[model samples]
Target: MKEVTPTDSEEHVRRRVSEKCSVDESPRFSRQQSFGRDIGHAAAETYLVTRLSFNLLGYLGLGYQWITRLLALACYAMLLMPGFLQVAYLYFFSPQVKRSIVYGDQPRNRLDLYLPPTSDGLKPVVIFVTGGAWIIGYKAWGSLLGLQLAERDIIVACLDYRNFPQGTISDMVGDVSHGISFVCKNISAFGGDPNRIYLMGQSAGAHISSCALIEQAIKESRGESISWSVSQIKAYFGLSGGYNLFKLVEHFHNRGLYRSIFLSIMEGKGSLEKFSPGVRLKDPRVKKAASLLHHIVLFHGSADYSIPPEASKTFADALRAVEVKTDIIIYEGKSHTDLFLQDPLRGGKDELFDHIVSMIHAEDSDALTKDAVAPERKRLVPEFLLKLAGKVSPF
Candidate 1:
């Protein structure tokens, strides 16, 4: 891990601001520049929506079950539009956000950073991978979480990678690994503590990140050279993610992700064992690799039929069997998006969010003190709308 002093951190920030200003300044053609940027953003949004619509239609034919579920999902989204729009605005225009930082040579190898206001001391960092099944994941999906964590003085790096058709499971894992390597090496320049970095992923992202972490540990156990070490990571947090693909194949198939489509996303049935973190941990050869891991934490909702809480429970059991320090927290009656999206948007006090913040601030008395007195976040959507959205949510 690289150590950075206060002076070094300040100087780095100054250089970065100077460079950004140089690139951003266009006073002579300000009007034209603004018009061009708006046009570009509009085009990008159109392309994204069109692509997602086509992909979703392709996978889920026009079956009655899918059509009904799609209708419900759309209703859920509509009910939460107020919150979504607010979050989208912050994600695209917030001064605290640094968007589209390239991490690799691939077209989609980019990430967005959410930074805290004060850079006095090194802040704990989280490299978050957002969930969008396996076909629609994007870094912007993490903006809400990033904004909340940044307010509590934590740095967040939300990563983007190639989704299905464009890239398979192997490609996604490789992209995440590369993103982690970049953060582990370069975060110090951004006033992030290299020693306190955490890895977190939601839904499909959870599975992809776990595969990358386990694969890295395996490589290290074999004395293979690597860019980043598992030891460098403080902990791994899996949020509503499926660990054993074999157990989830049928579950996902029934939920609109057909087996054939899911199989192809996982690169066929032969790769199931290779990608399943829970199953891979049972292998004798991986014991040494597993021992290298610091801690594993899994969070899930008891009512999440999308993947089921049993997935986290079983994975936790496997981690303990391997002698890895592990903990699983189940939110009773909470749905998949409730813990990740609705709860955060509903705003006041969130048990899951509190738990995460408590863990991150355990060793810092001052940080914990600040967190305890922090003002409650204002609700983005009305209580009635939130309730309606929850009832209509397909996930």
Candidate 2:
């Protein structure tokens, strides 16, 4: 967090001026300064939500704080409940609960699949990795996305990975690699096109996905083999991924040391170089090939306060510098979770679904061969739902 000073005052002044003009470093400021810079950011978010036309009546109808508080408390209880017990709540109780989403299974892991009836064959598969930073989250959060992806005729898979608070990011990605391996081995059997599989992750999940891809890229370059069946993925979609955990550790608090602790917990030691994708990019050759833009898509809300949209910008800039094909869609005023869940701030779900569909369409043809005409699609959601209705997690 501390910036180095030049012994010569003039040189120090020059460096500051240069930084101010540089797109890369200009907006990165002290946390205190950053916290205060969001007056307009807040307003912009509010305007966006209103413009998007959320159910205003729904917001108004829930009139009391006590009502909202009670609902939130109930959700908290559900989250804190033990897993086997939670399954019971999902199964025998919770009258309002819907049926569990259907998924595919490997011997050791399971995946919840969301398939759109409207489109298939050439459609892309968006593989989701939910974030809980690294310590939390499970397959349950992925259920909404299953339904979301079903709307667009694209197939979706919410993968299960190992967790931390116990394991490290590596364990998570290892599990992810295996889950993907399972998908590659058996996806076509279930009507998914393996060649078109794309990775979409949030928070810690994003970091894990990026690392796994880097590992896969490295393995491919060295002609090394891993347990996973597939080595290459078509693209990545990162939502509020923590690319620079070091920054959060160094400047914001003393928590940077936790990374070493995390490393110790996972791998029995710490190596920033081993854990960080940003650090891994120091080698120009590796960076050139591993850049996700060539095979990925990024969605980030500019107003995200938790992880800092700068992380996305940093990753995008790094990818773009290498001339990798990347598209960054920044919702002018939105936050982290808001990118995925309903955000009163910005109207983007339909657009998000639309973009996902179009991306699938674009990647479908070029996926295995050269790109082709969009397949004639009709009633994609209904048929896909029918096929998935009686299914369960396969793993």
Candidate 3:
């Protein structure tokens, strides 16, 4: 120590810091490289095939029939096939699943309940809502998620609600509310803990779920229909959801068919404030239900062009602004349909699946009870202005 020189000490400190940095970063770098390689390879193959098909179709004078047939096949493959396979698996493999439980009077108001293989006592429940642009969703679409969660000892309920042309957004919301009401009262019979219910919805399902939560909060505030408090639903998992209607109004402005469909879902009214959960929660009228906002965990794909990731970001910001505890997880390079397609059981498991499982098991004591410290306030402005507007209209 008496012979130590400043130059030697500085070199020693630098060497130690370099060693620490190498230890911390090597694994992360390796993982990132592997992920990038996989995504790049897939993207390249898809691009090449698509380009080749386009060139061949152009050369062959592709007709409308071919396009129509191709579109139909794609819809079947993307929207129907996965759900069918999932339902088939559950039916053939999982013996504990109960199918077609009527939750309401309407024909579409039916749900499928999946119970774990072994249950010793009351289990936490996950009520999953499927997304199909508020136009063509089925409860069976949630079969994959329902079965997956049930395998983890969580009770799962996949609900169906009337889509556009058959029912308006308000009606669909009512149907989900009814489904939830039924689950609340009857799930105990299936060995579920009514107190630990979790609401999970994707895309349009997420929008409807948000509406239901706010509606419940309103009812609880007024002391009307207080049978099930909003807080009773331990958490909300909003995957690729549109929480703000104003952003969507701009987003779908150019897309004609979807614009009309979205308008119909809003009952042909431009009530952005009324239908938007983000805007609605900020209103002074909704202060009573502010406590429930902390229960939200928004998940979105970074490459989700169907519904821009910004939707979740802005929604989370709004909730956090009001002091509600909220969390957002971004899945890098994943698209809208890619999220569910990466099934955990099928060896296509991704970080999103792990996140979902973790949240489902998260204890109530671990939940945040107070508003997080607000970051420095910026000039008040519209949320969409902060980022270019964005998804699937359904959750």
Candidate 4:
């Protein structure tokens, strides 16, 4: 072969990076000008269309509130049975769906707990935040997650945080923070180990859960009941979750549904600096506190359709950048919700406690007791981490 030239070496490097990104090529000087123009035009069209739709919706929201309410009520009345049927599937099809609690002021948006039978001692705990793209969701999402943890002898709680139409993402986080504090404080009463609670959520729930860890809710009453340790949180497991609202809005082009759904999440309070996880990293505390190394766990599906894999990938890279201890599980062929509900896990569905058992046993060697880590369950920690150290050393 002829001697490789400097130009050839540069071309090879560019190609390698392009392949890694799964794009034909990086936006480079070599790209034709027409390509940029075409992309700009497409983006402009999308923006204009979305802006018009949002403008129209603003009018409808302001001028037709009662009309819309009546229509919505009529629809709900017609679909009440279907709604109930959907709930039945959630209860029967999903093992994690457990009981609800009337803990919040509104009562409708209250907390719920799901705990497995455990001995008198304290066991690990996992707090679940459900996802409804920030608009609609319920406390039952955490039930399935809680039951799994219970089977592993680790307690689980599915919280009911304030939702949109009445709260922002910041407000939701505040609600969750209180919810977390409430649930943790009462774990002992519910037969749980308050010291070992982990904050977990999916999608929008994950976003607010992240906010809860980073930002303290507007000065809440702190008491002995609110005592918690980040170390004890162990980690955050975000399944196709953790969408940076700023980037998410950009990713979806500020469309009507996207805006209504997302803006409603934050009470129209989203700021670039406040909403994006990547941007938030610029803050000293976020950079210092963020990482699987500290007390966060990240889970994402490589082929997720609801949210891009890059959502987790972006946060994962950030965690790695800080040398924080974070673990990510990318279900190679799984989608967004698959990682949550019982689906084809390793090709077959399992009992309600499958994921919880895996997560707890994952660190069995580091656990106080193998039986306690998961008791009779299997390990959920990464295989490499498990094999790297033959013994358990959680610290």
Candidate 5:
């Protein structure tokens, strides 16, 4: 029997074959990954389209009017897709973003927190409730605002709650209040200052949060045992919100929100005055409760058709009538989404962003000085796209 020894060339040939086999498999593996991603993306798009379609049908019914608005909305979204995608990526993957943190026991009772880079001091907190009419409301809607504020050393808690169909107006209010209580009690663990917590909401969120704030105040005035105190909130900021459901119901109906759907979200016409912050404050019994409310600042766009600037104006006047300090700022020619979306996407020194930051940092001279010299934010969407989006926006 003879033993054979392999030569170096033979061994080299064997290794080369192994390397070739590995190389051939690599592309297949990469292709599989790519295919999986494509499938996931397709599924997400289908889900979103289906959900949006169902919501539209439920809220506006089957009509040419809604179909036309949907087309416009689709065009608007596509035009702003570049900015939306970037923010979505950051929202889902950024280390600074802590998503789906539970604040209550109910389903959808979750919130997302945007943490600043440095935890040097207890930073001011903004508990933000996002808007989505009533059916599509979700906390992720505030990702852009949360990320921007977090960059300025602010802690942002974007609260998620049960939307219409899942729950009614009262449920949404309760969820927001519960979320606020959680943040007020636990935000310190995340480097948020308890005393300087500010409450903020946009559109429907503004209405919901306002209701929660008012309800809490009324409870406190009545000596009801509460999980959170109105005194704990430093201020309330309502952005393009409707406060008087009594006034807004018909307006919303004409604007495509529809009377039936609007009434249902509001728990019917009978409950409209009960949920209306402006109307509720006019009552003498709630005057003491209103007095306990912190400063309120309302921001609305003059050209906003979703909810008119007068909604904010009338609410501010109501707050003043009860001796509560209130202020309303209106941006001329700005649409419903312009101040919140387009301006932020166009990115430099945003007037609304600056106004909010300035107020939040009012007590901190050093922060104000830093902000004064802070570099302008990089633009996400092109000017042309933003203009097109504005024209096509259904909101």
Candidate 6:
């Protein structure tokens, strides 16, 4: 009924076209038209499709991320199950264990001592140190080890030292020294024998313990006061440790996770030589103390990709070359973590565990008979007999 002018007709057509479009389609059409005007229709269509695909991918990526995280958590949970069970048994089941005994002023300088159920007398001691690449270690990591040794009637001293980013390698090693001193001075009350102490460490812990021993040896040679005697260490057990820092740096230079940590631990260039056990073992000071090295035992997993078995082999060879009594134990088809998980209670057994029990048994036997001396100590018998003969009147 209204008059149809050209301008009125044009306005009516525009309003009708807008009403026909859906809400989302209207904005997309406007954008496409603007883009088409600037960069042809074909190119604008391609851009719109690409944008749509990107938005869809973003939504899908979020779900994929969560799925990956769940898978990783599942894997970790399975790996930690064995250690968790051991720790649970130690805390809830074992009642004789003394825990959180402070050794130094720092909070991290505490240790746990696991005493055998039968407190008949002083027991052979094993001081264990757990590894965390010198960066991440907790005293709880040694709970399984302490329980294992305690079951064999050996006193177990599990130590916790300051970790990196909180303390430097020097501080970490110092904590170990302080802990050893404390153990030597006070372990008798806990049923631990000061004379029959064995030093055992795994991975980064091995490096720290070895360094502490080497340092102690150096101190004794220089007539410095050492809280504990090098001879008191009946044997040194190093498991999956990298003795040569120089080589370790070279080996892991490009590794994304370890490279930065190694660089931080070493401090700067040329500092690796200072902390390297293999390098220091060859030093004149350490060589002088080699005679007091006693028995050294090294364990390595052949299938370990994190740290090759060659590291242990090279270190054992070095010790042998220096005339130190050394033994190497190899675990075939075992990964780095497999060494700890191979618990008899976990439905598996490790050869190194048996070797440790033997060491403790042998040490205990020596203590029961004062006349018995280790085969390595046979050379000192002549002097011991001479002193005995002088003390006796008429035999």
* Pairs that collide, model 5: none
lDDT (tens digit, per residue) of candidate 2 on 1-395:
11222122434433432332233433545333433433443365357445422432232244453345345535543432343243333322222222222222322144555555543364567778887646445555665555545555566777766554334566677777766665555445446677777788887778887777777776766667664423346777777776655554443223222434344434643445666666666567675345433455677777666567777778777666666666777777666555554331122334555566667677344442422233322322232332232121110
Per-prediction TM-score:
0.92, 0.61, 0.71, 0.62, 0.87, 0.71
Lowest-scoring 10 consecutive residues by lDDT in candidate 4? 386-395
Name the better of 2 and 3 by TM-score: 3
Per-model lDDT:
0.88, 0.53, 0.68, 0.55, 0.86, 0.68
Cα lDDT for residue 236, candidate 2: 75
- Writing each residue's lDDT as its tens digit, candidate 3 over 1-395 gives 01211223334423432332244457879557545644664476457446545554543354554355456546435444444554565553454766556666774777777888776878889888898767557786787677666766789988889776567888888889888877777677678898889898999999898888888887777778654667668888999999988788657544323455467668765666777889988888788777655478999889887679999999999888777789999888766665764333233334776677667665633221211221222222232321211121121
Point out where model 5 deviates above 4 Å: 1-60
For model 4 the local lDDT of residue 10 reads 38
Which of the predicted structures, 1 or 2, would earn the higher TM-score when compared with the native? Answer: 1
Specify the highest-lDDT model's number: 1
* Every candidate's CA RMSD: 4.1, 22.0, 20.3, 23.2, 12.7, 27.2
lDDT of 2: 0.53
Candidate 6 lDDT for residue 87? 65
Winner on TM-score (4 vs 6)? 6
Candidate 4 structure, TM-score to reference = 0.62
lDDT of candidate 6 over 201-318, digit per residue (tens): 9888998999888888888877888778888888999988888887777565443224555667667556677777777777766778877788999998897765788889988888
Q: Candidate 1 lDDT, tens digit per residue, 1-395?
A: 12222223445543654343245557656546544754675587569657767876786677776778778988999999999999987876676887766678875787889999888899999999999888878898899999999999999999999888678999999999999998888888788999999999999999999999999999999999998999989999999999999999999889888888899999999999999999999999999999999989999999999989999999999999999999999999999999999999999999988988888888999999999999998899999999999988989
For model 4, state the Cα shift of residue 280 in Å: 1.0
